[model samples]
Target: MPFINTSSPHQQNQSSVPDLMRKVLLALIPGALACLYYFGFGVLVNIVIASATALASETIMLNLRHYPVRRYLTDYSALVTAILLALALPATVPWWLTVIATSFAIVIAKQLYGGLGYNPFNPAMIGYVVALIAFPQQMTQWPVPQPGGALGLLDVLLLQLTGTLSDPAILDAVTSATPMDQIKTGIGLNRTIGEISTGALFGTVAGRGWELVNLLFLLGGLWLLWKKVINWQIPVAVLSALFFWSWMFNLYDGDLYSSPFFHLFSGGTMLCAFFIATDPVTASTTHWGRLIYGMGIGILTFIIRNWGGYPDGIAFAVILMNMAVPTIDYYTQPRVFGHQDED
Candidate 1:
C-alpha cells in the first residue's frame, strides 16, 4: 500500500502565495490613492521604480541562490515589499535612492535571509531604515503637499531623475518640513505642544494633509480585517498600547506631551499598526505572543518618537520588536492536546 505522507494543515484553503499577495496589494490601494492625492504623482513614480528594482533584484538573487526563479517570482512577495518601502519613502526622493533601497530589501533583507518566511525582520522596513541611515539628507527631503503649492508632477520627476532643478529656488519653494519634522523642531526650540499644534503644519489632530492619508490607511486596514487577510490581535494590541502610552504622557504634562489623537493620526502610526506589525511570517505565530509583540512595538515606537532621536519611529520600533518574537512565541505557546501540565 502506497500511503500519502502529508503535512499538518490537511484542511485546504483556495489561497496561494500569489493570491494572498494580491489581496494585500488590494488592501493598500486606498492608502496609495490618498498619498497620491496629497503628495503628487511622485508617489506613483516611486512605486514603479521600487517595484521594478525589487523584481530585478529578486530574480538576480534567486538565480544566485540556485532557487527556481519562476516559482518565487510569480508569488509577488517581492512586489509587495517594494510597494511598502516606496510608500514609506518621501514622495520626491531621488530615483537612485529608491532603486538602492528596493534592491537591498529584496537581495539582502529577504533573499539572503532564506527568502520570505525565514527573514527575521520586515524586509520593507529594513530597506527604509538603511536608506534613512545611509542618506539622511536625501531621505528627509519630503515634498510639500499639493495644497501647499508644491511643484507639478513633471518638475518633481525631472528633479528626481537629474537631481537638479531649472531654478534651485523651485526646490526650496516646493519642499518643506514634514509635520513630524516641524513638531520635532518646535520641541527642540522649547515650544509647547499648544504652540506647535497651532503651526501651519498642523490641521486638526496631526499634519495638514497627513490626517487624511492616515484616515485612508485606517480604512484600508479595516478592509484587511474584514477580508480576513490579517488577524485582529496585532492591530488591536498596537493601537491600544500606543493610545495608553500617549494618554499617560499627555496627562502627565499636557504642555510637553502630545495628545493621543496626534499620536494616532500622525506619520505612519496607522500604517504600521495595521500592515507592518501584522506581517504573518515575521510576527509571532501563537495568539498570546502576537499581542505581546504588538505591545512591544507600540511602546517602543512611543518612546523613540517622544524621547529618542527619530521623529517617527515605526521602522525602528517594528525591527526592534521583530527580534523579540521568538521569546514571545516560546512563552505563549499553546499546550498540546493530550499533554498534561508538568508539576
Candidate 2:
C-alpha cells in the first residue's frame, strides 16, 4: 500500500470556507432583525423573495453553464449574496425589483465573471447599483416602522406571496421618503439643516429608530471581529474617517451640513462598514492595504455623499474600491520571510 502524505512540505493554513460563510450569515442576523424591527414586514418579504429568486436563478444558470449545480448552489454563497442585496435595498421594494437585482447579482456580476472568488466587484453591490440606477424611485423610498405591528414570519411570507401589505392605499400613504430625500427636498427649498430637524423630520438618530438598528449591526460587527472572522482595520478606519470628517465639516458650517451623529448612523454606513467593505475577496488582504482601502472608502463615501448625486455613497464607494483592490494589494504586499529590500 502506498503511504499517504498528510503533511505539507511546510505547515499549511486552512479554514472551512463554508463554516466561515455560515458565520457571516449568522453575523447578519442582528442587523436583519433590527432592520425588520424598524422597517416592518417589508424587509422580511424582501429576503424571502430575493433569496428564492437568487437560488432559482443560480440553478438555472448552472444548468446553462453545464456546471454541477449542487456543488456551487449548496455552498451558501447565493444565500449570503441574496441577504446582502435584500438588506441593502429598501424593504418595500417591489418583488419584481428584488428578483431582478438578485438575478443580476448571481448571473451577471458573479457567474459571468466566473463564480465566487473570481469576480472582481462585490456581486451584491453590483446588483444594488443596477437597481438604484434603473429604478431610483423604488430603491429610495423608505417605510416608517409601525413599532408594535411588525408582521410575523408567516404573515410576511403571505405578504410576499400576495404582493400586498394590508391595505394598498394606506401602504402608499405611509411609505414616506428617506431622510436623504427629505434633506434634498429641504435643500431645494433653501431650508437649513436646523430647519429640517424640526417637526416630522426628526433625525430619530438618522431617521426614526434607524440609529438603534445601526447600533445593533455595529454590535454584531464587533462580535465578528472578536471571533476572528473579520479584521478591525477596515471597519474602524472607515467609520472613524467618516465620523471625524463629518464632525469637522458640520462644525465648520452648522447650517450647511448634517451632524456627525447623522453621518454615523444614517443610510448604509453601518451595513457597508461592517458587512460589505469587509468582504475578504474584494477588500485588501494585507494589514496596511486594508487601512488604505478602508480610508479610501471612507473619504470617497464622504465626498460622494457631500458632492456626488447620491445621498448615500457607501455602495458606490465599495464598488469603486473593489476595482482598485488588485492595485492596492500589489503595492502593499507584506515583506516575505527571507527577502532583501530592493535597496
Candidate number achieving the greatest TM-score relative to the actual structure: 1
Candidates in order have lDDT scores of 0.88, 0.83
Task: Give, for candidate 2, the lowest lDDT window spanning 10 residues.
Answer: 148-157
Would you list the clashing residue pairs of candidate 2? none
lDDT of 2 by residue, 1-343 (tens): 9987686556654556677778888989998898887778778788988899999998998899899999888788899899999988887677888999999999999889888788898999999999999999878777765563345555445445666655556556556777766776787788998888773636565766677778888888888888888899999989988988988999999777888888888888888898889988788899989999999899888888877887788889999999998999999998898999899
TM-score of each: 0.95, 0.90
User: Which number leads on lDDT?
Assistant: 1
Tens-digit lDDT track of model 1 for 158-195: 88888887788888777777777877788899999899
Model 1 ranges off by over 4 Å: 1-11, 147-149
**Model 1 quality (TM-score):** 0.95
